[model samples]
Target: MDGSRTAALLGVVLLVTACGQPAREPGPTGCAGGVPSCAPSTAPPSTAPTTPAPSRPVTVLRGTVQAGVEAGCLVLATDRGRFLLLGGDPTVLREGAEVVVEGATRPGQATTCQEGTPFSVSAARAEPATTR
Candidate 1:
């Protein structure tokens, strides 16, 4: 064959050889292609925003019971703050007796009795004074 024809044939063979070769690197996608078991599925990233849950109210309290500002109810005095306890026997709670008052609390029961947040007492226990 003439020199031009031989060169053209050689160029075509090189192009075909390059086209038939497999890709050596997986790149950013991270998975191999065409060996179906080897390639990880390509899925679009999730766009949903994350959010925190709302906080809940307190349900338990331990403190000393004191007389309400008026009468007919009682107040719990802890180191944290005072709270008005309802729904349990107020007689068991003396002015200085330590007690465990269990209930939910909310702002503004709008009572003439106490100046603290109102708590509904589900159960009560008078913790005895330590002798020491």
Candidate 2:
């Protein structure tokens, strides 16, 4: 046989041998022996329920009430910082009133008033007058 004929016969034999073999099943590592570096996963999924963090405590602020630049916006100027009061007694939250307010500071709360931290007022009272 010529060299070409022998090479053709050898190629046909190799193809036939490869086609007759069964495919290998993947190991527990999800990789066939085709990859030598794969390892099986050992960590298990967690089943415990997760608890939410507690809410923040309410804040008390003492300051003189002042109206914001925008109409209907009330602001309190305290030593701590300025606070925009929301949902308090209209009489107690009047402009120029010296008052003590109890509420939570809602930094994320949206408002038309551009000044001061947004405060949701639960209660408010005017400061008692003092004799000189």
Candidate 3:
């Protein structure tokens, strides 16, 4: 074959061999196609979810029966702050006694303690001076 033809054939063989060869180590800058810059990461960035704080502070109320009225059988006291208990729960407790009430509270029947407006207890337990 002619010299020029032989050179052309050799060039084609080299190109084909290079394309068929296995990949080499990535270049210094990473896979930015010869550009000295790092390739974009496939992994996503991490983030944390936000949480809400508590609504209102707990109302831990406690106090003594300041007064008791038999009108509707109600007792008034200054619990955590100020409270008025409703009807004397025969199954629960009575007047002039220490009591521990819990749960959402509101005003009860009218009594001398607070005048018809008494603190209501969702639950009440009379604390006796002496255990019976």
Q: Which stretches of candidate 3 lie over 4 Å from their true place?
A: 1-60, 66-70, 79-81, 107-117, 128-132
Q: Per-residue lDDT of 13-93 in model 3, one digit per residue for the tens?
A: 866766675655564435423222344456656577768874433233444555444454454455245555654454554
Give TM-scores for every candidate, taking all chains together and pairing residue i with residue i.
0.50, 0.57, 0.35
What local lDDT score does residue 7 receive in model 2, on the 0 to 100 scale?
Answer: 100
In terms of lDDT, the best-performing candidate is 2
Model 2: clashing residue pairs? none
The digit string of per-residue lDDT tens for model 1 on 106-132 reads 675777775778887777888765788
Which residue pairs in candidate 3 have backbone atoms (N, alpha carbon, C) closer than 3 angstroms, thus clashing? 61-80, 62-80, 84-119, 108-118, 110-116, 111-116
Pairs of residues clashing in candidate 1: none
Alpha carbon lDDT of residue 5, candidate 1?
A: 100
Please give, for residues 32-69, the per-residue lDDT of candidate 2 as tens digits: 44343445446676678888887767899999999899
Score residue 59 of candidate 1 by CA lDDT: 74
Better of 1 and 3 by TM-score: 1
Which one wins on TM-score? 2
lDDT of each: 0.74, 0.85, 0.53
lDDT score, candidate 3? 0.53
Better of 2 and 3 by lDDT: 2
